[model samples]
Target: MSALILVVDDEPDVAELFRQQFRKELRASRFDMEFAQSAPEALERVGAAEAARLILILSDVNMPGMSGIELLPRARKARPDVPVIMITAYRDSETRPKAIEAGAAGLFTKPIDFPELRGEIGRRLDAATGPQ
Candidate 1:
């Protein structure tokens, strides 16, 4: 089965950019991508794919209706095993702790280095799958 990644961001451009980047950057054909523009939408996707097949979630911290911090606990409730990594333009000691406390696997700044990010994501996904 393919490893699925749910990307939640209020910015359509950013979401699409990541989608394209994932496709271009990932060597694995079994990596599937999905996107949501809001926290509620992300939650819905998580609920729908809560079964063990789903792998990871990458979300932006600042959004109109619900920030990533707000969504983290909720997502965890539905899919505790899935790791949610928060992305933001503002990365500092203050925001990082809040995200960690809220249950983020990690935090990344925007203008993300796709190659590096892909490597990290791949590691997390591999970790989720356990030993081969």
Candidate 2:
């Protein structure tokens, strides 16, 4: 079965960006992606069969409600094994520590580098699934 990635971002375009960047992997059935515009919505998607296939969650830190940092624990509650990476344009240094404390596996600053992100995803997935 193909692995799944749940991407949560308040900016609608970010979802498209991830989809486009991962197109090659998606086409190869190496990964499948899903989008959620908010934390609550992302939490809801993290269950059942989808949860089992989900290898990673890429989430933006800033949002209208329940910021990514706040949503971290809740997401863990639903799917404890799934790794979450925080993506944001904000430069506040404090955010990183908070995200780590809240259970984020990594924090990535934006204008995201898709290649780097993809590399990290691949590494994490390999670690999770044992070398594809």
Candidate 3:
């Protein structure tokens, strides 16, 4: 079975970019992509999809309500086994330390390197669900 990956970002366009970047794998059902526009929405999706095997969560740091840093602990409470990686344009000393403290699996600065992102996702997915 393919791994489900929820991407939490306020930007609506990011979902499209992810879909485009992983189009081949998506079409082949190697990975399933889900999107959430806010931290609340991400939590809701995560809660609702309890039966689904989610391998990773890619979250944006900045948002109108409940930034990724704020949401990390809550997310971990909900899905402790799943890795939550922060993806944001802001990469400063302040936010980095906060994210690390909040237990982010990794922090990725935008514009992200799609190849590296894909590789990490693939590895995580494999680790979570075994070979596709």
Which candidate number maximizes TM-score? 3
Better of 1 and 3 by lDDT: 3
Question: What is the alpha-carbon lDDT for the whole of candidate 3?
Answer: 0.89
Clashes of 2: 0
By TM-score, rank the candidates, best first.
3, 2, 1
**TM-score quality measure for candidate 2:** 0.94
Candidate 1 off by > 4 Å? 25-28, 130-132
Candidate 2 lDDT over 40-119, as tens digits, reads 89888886536558888889999998999888999888888888999989889799999999999999999898888989
Model 3 Cα lDDT, one tens digit per residue, 1-132:
568999999999999999999999899999899999999999999888755578799999999889899899999999889889998897687887788889999989999999999889889977987776
Off by over 4 Å in 2: none
Model 2 Cα shift for residue 12 (angstroms): 1.1
TM-scores of the models, in the order given? 0.90, 0.94, 0.95
lDDT of each residue in 67-110, candidate 1, tens digit only:
89999999988888888899999857798999999899988898
Cα error, residue 22 of model 1, in Å, equals: 1.6
Report the error of model 3 at residue 47, Å: 0.5
